[model samples]
Target: MVFSNNDEGLINKKLPKELLLRIFSFLDIVTLCRCAQISKAWNILALDGSNWQRIDLFNFQTDVEGRVVENISKRCGGFLRKLSLRGCIGVGDSSLKTFAQNCRNIEHLNLNGCTKITDSTCYSLSRFCSKLKHLDLTSCVSITNSSLKGISEGCRHLEYLNLSWCDQITKDGVEALVRGCRGLRALLLRGCTQLEDEALKHIQNYCHELVSLNLQSCSRVTDDGVVQLCRGCPRLQALCLSGCGSLTDASLTALALNCPRLQILEAARCSHLTDAGFTLLARNCHDLEKMDLEECILITDRTLTQLSIHCPKLQALVSQLLVVDLPLRDERCPATLPHYRRNLLSGRVSSIILGFRGLLVGLTWEVENLRVTVFVFGCEPNTGTQVLTQIHGQPVE
Candidate 1:
């Protein structure tokens, strides 16, 4: 490209090499690609490894082929820190082999929805990319225990992993993972149906640093599995047992007795859970914030009242088809009601989804030092079945 007397490509000629690279770092991937086409000098500056440190190819997932990933890996090389190739169906093990070899310093990699890749891709990652920390392999159906073995062999610094919907994963794979990667803090095994109680045992024994675990839909896990898990992982804060039909109240009892720092608990669809389990939990775990008791048929208003009285830090409570009861009388209401109502009025309790068969009928009363405003949702105005919907000091319609 010829520059006129007024232009003279003065900017590129006058600027230092460091300043030119610094300027190119501000451009996005599309703009960088466009800039690379201007001239030889601009092409070298635009394709510099430092400028391509973090690349997210999710926008071009459908159009991106394996060659694009390989070329990017080569260009970025040791300078690349993060790369996301999510939903790129065309990316296979062969391209990933080159990527892992070239970009060995890559820290965070997302291969989610890349269906064409198999265990060979994991093998490449394990051979290189030793500094890998976070990985999202969600919906990678082709992955099996062999892939877990590869990840366990390497990726020791891995802290967060999402293996959601990977159907082939079993107890053996989980054991191998936790045995090697004991530093794992969060593991999402949602929808991995093949996992049984043995896998939980392995996680309890090996992964002691685990704080967050999602066992959603792992139907084979019984109360015994949860007991072992809670006994071992005392640092557990967030636990999801949604759709695990085999779990009973014993699991909740185990959690309450062991995990004192328990904050978020999701036991939706666990039919055997009663108010007895939750009453004990609320008394023991005062830091509880979010509770999802949807589809728990056995629990009544007793559970709701107990949680409101004891768990002062409670924010979101999702109890669909359950009655909400908050006694207003001076003798009946506990001293903690004032503190709970204060937290509610101060906007700490942002969401309280209590579903009952009724319409909102306003009611306000003074119980001890607290002036509480309750929105009672009852089937009929005359009926005595009053369900407390909110406690925001002002009437909620």
Candidate 2:
């Protein structure tokens, strides 16, 4: 287009090539498509290799087809680092294979909920994307032990692998991964229904560098499996045995003695766990920060007291206390209050924001025919001169 001195086009052309490309780089993939259609200069700037470091197809329309994926992959070439194709059901094994072949430098790949992909796609990914480190295959139901063969052989650098709800994989595949990918740090096998003690034993035997292990909903994993696994994985920082109801105090006792580095442990719905096991954990695992023991009927206030005293790092506790719904009624019960140690700035401790004194009150509620009293401790749960005495499922006025 012809332009005078005041023309916007004339002014934009006067800008340096570096400045033009830098401006184009800020545009997202969809916006870049529009930029490419504007003019020849903008088209060249949009396709520049630096502008395509990350391609997340989840940002685009649901109908992103195989040709679109192939074109994007070709444009990216070897520059792609992070590619998220989460829920991109229109594209499958063929398009993903094309991507894996071109983007060799890819590190993080999120293919969560891509139902059309099978073991062949995983094989292609392993053969081509050798630099792959993080992979999320959550809900890829077609994925089986055959996929592990590809991952085990080539994806040696893989550290974080999430196979959550990929129910097709079994003990054989899991065991192969543990043995082959010794560098595996975080492996999530939640809802792999066929997995049992056999896979846990394999993990215990081989996966030593593991820090986070999620065996939640693996109903077959019992206390024996946990005992064996904890004995091997001493560096475990986070462990989720949620819904593993078969586990007893034996598992907790083993973890307390073995996993001193354990910080976060979630045993939600583990009805068999008792105070004896949790107390052992609190006294031993000084680095413990968060613990979930909901539905563990045997766990009482004693464990809470022990955690408050022994675990200095404990910030969040999910014991039965968090679930206790104090019904609104006129009932008085003497609560044996735990002396909560507060950070002492002066000789006396105060919850008051200002340097003044405040009134202290106690709370009493009935649960299971037993009246329990809770002496209010910690920062006052009030907002702008309001007091909240009892909080049920919903907030109180």
Candidate 3:
């Protein structure tokens, strides 16, 4: 029953269309919906062409259909810059065609779970909207190489594309994308098991601007494939090779040597990697901030010490070091002895304390089952933990 400034409604008609549009822009989606019910004038302004620039119909996915999107697109009058239909399962090729026809100015479109649509939508985009910048086809199994070819031929301005879990796609599809979209920056091919070295090789050959690549669960991508990928794409920053069981020292070596801007690397479940692979990474990749080495059974204390000495900014170390059998030669022993000691007494890894080499000289880090605190070198008895703790700052436990 209530509305914005009831007295101002009387003079709202006198306001210029541009000013009215600007004023309507300040209202949130909920407020605009309420205003639409107030009167005909308010309704017209509420659904104005300028007001529909970014339509996020993801929340209304369960309730809305193609007609809703069509209506919004018509109201937008080709100014819909960003549209996200994240889980609108009912949307199909016809709905996308209608959207493409009306919202020609749309630059970013997210149809992550729109399963009913196929390559027809891609063809529609190629025919109608050529300037699309971002597209998410996650889990859209209906699409094939034809759609990728269509996108490659038309969407030349495409920058970010997510084909994650689209197992139907092959090397040819991505090859087309690489050839068409030169400025492509971020590409996610997670779970694209059908693709092998050929896909990455082609991308490295053409898509020079690529920065972040996620090939998690890509079983066929061997160390040779990754070596080639790293050799070409030098500016790569984030790479996720989770579930890539075949990766070894060769892949890590290539990444360390080539990708100077590398920051995040998720190598979880890469069971073949050992201490040598990580040691090479630490020695070369000094800028590494986060690294996931979970399930790497062969790694020990040397790798952790290398990371601590090399990567000054290393923040996260996703490793199974603490949970595994606490071996004396393990990397966690030297790098995080204080943590292990704390956890041994308490439930969680308390702070063991370490600064001067692997052995902190004070804590009883298990010597033949008996607790024997060893004081080696100039470290007196009580000052060992204090001196090191002061140097390393507060306790990490």
Which structure among the candidates has the greatest TM-score? 3
TM-score result, candidate 3: 0.81
Encode model 3's per-residue lDDT on 166-283: one tens digit a residue.
Answer: 9989999989988989889999999998989899999889878889999999999998889888988898989999998988889999998998788889998998888898888888
Pairs in clash, predicted candidate 1: none
Candidate 1 per-residue C-alpha lDDT over 215-264 given as tens digits, one digit per residue, 9 for 90 to 100: 99999999989999999899999999999997888998999999999989
Residue 104, candidate 3: alpha-carbon lDDT? 83
Report, for every candidate in turn, its global Cα lDDT versus the true structure. Answer: 0.82, 0.75, 0.77
Ranking by lDDT: 1, 3, 2
Segments of candidate 2 deviating more than 4 angstroms = 1-12, 321-387, 390-397
Better of 2 and 3 by TM-score: 3
Q: Residue 25 of model 1: what lDDT?
A: 98
Best by lDDT: 1
Please count the clashing residue pairs in each candidate, in the order shown: 0, 0, 7
Candidate 2 has an lDDT of 0.75
